[model samples]
Target: MVIPTFETTFAVPMTCEACIKDIEGSLKQLNGIQKISANLKEQLVSIEGTAAPSAIVDAIQSTGRDAILRGSGKSNSAAVCILESHAPHVENKVRGLARMVQVAPNLTIVDLSIRGLSPGTYHATVRETGDISEGPESAGAIWEAFKAKEGTACRGVFGTVEVSKGGVGTVFLDRPIQIWEMIGRSIVVARQEDGKFDKNDPDTLVGVIARSAGVWENDKTVCSCSGKTVWQERQDEVGRGML
Candidate 1:
């Protein structure tokens, strides 16, 4: 029998390695927790296993730390990344998250938030596919191309979020769009303040968040080859068998 697994990301406020150990200790008690990794810089926790999302979130919260479900590549899609400086001479300490909820078939609500950024107005937009092999940009590359026109990526611009002196802000877009439209795409937060996608200047880009999957797909699918699901069979057969 093959045991299936699921991956989920959580926004966790971890100040140090102790916090990560505490979270891991708490979650390790639960069955099906295959792996857990904490990204302190991004303040995010990534877990891969067969455990339930709620169970994992609850376990993390039990450690006396606040936790938010960034995205699970399931139900509602989510993407997360730490904002990086476009200018080599500058340093960025911002963290960004983008989540899409399917309220209706034709309409989706995009929720975005960023922390530890300079206090100011920022623009959010979706560019063309990016190259994710470049560290944080690896996932960010999902939506790196920006060809600003009237109704193209500009239309995907959710809006702006203002970071206060404390370096936190949020923006959202409640419009008509399908879940499939955003799956495997990327969301970008820019400090340019123009609300326009400028392909000419790379400095306009600030941070990026990449959604791993779409909500339209049933993330939890099973197969009946002696309890081996389709995904499991594919995994087993990959690079090891002749058809």
Candidate 2:
């Protein structure tokens, strides 16, 4: 099968040609990468490949530099969600993040990452409603539109991720769903009990999916709302364990 390829751009700290060479060299070792372009002036690296965005970020970080995904896919084809725990007394609620990009009409790539969770298998699914007033219970059931159209079980199931001993887990998945269908929905990640997810689990992380910028769609270096540069915002997100 031919894997679909899409372009993703990231903001990296590149000072000179050597920095670019180091990042390009590391990415070249990964499969599915067809092109790599680094701009020293813009501190941006654009990659065209079938590799997961998380993998690409890992590769760039391996070079001792942080990589911030600036944009992905075509115009209006990407979305993002920041998963947070609504459990009582949880000091730091942000637990995970999900990046979604529609690479094909029916294919959306979801790059999921989680930290500060117990070491075990967890299931992720898209809920029918974005409401989380009562946590996962209020998020409604797994999206049923795909089930009704395709005559299958709930299609909102995005499979599972195995959390490591260090409380970190990451998974890259592609589902036969469009990005538009997911906007304003809620994504929940929770530990399984008896091989099934329990919506009442207070520890289940939930977040509302919102549209994100596609390649070249966002170019501002400063945020108007926070009066912070892009790098500053990145630092804040990292400090909140959103990385």
How many clashing residue pairs appear in each of the predictions shown? 2, 0
lDDT of 2 by residue, 61-83 (tens): 99999999999999989999999
Task: Compute each candidate's TM-score over C-alphas.
Answer: 0.45, 0.93
What is the alpha-carbon lDDT for the whole of candidate 2?
A: 0.87
lDDT of 1 by residue, 11-63 (tens): 67789999999999999999879889888987778888756555676698799
Q: How accurate locally is residue 222 in candidate 1, as Cα lDDT from 0 to 100?
A: 52
How displaced is residue 84 in candidate 2, in Å?
0.6
- lDDT for 69 (candidate 2): 94
Candidate 2 stretches with Cα past 4 Å from truth are 145-153, 193-202
Q: Candidate 1: which stretches are off by over 4 Å?
A: 1-63, 68-83, 87-94, 131-154, 193-243
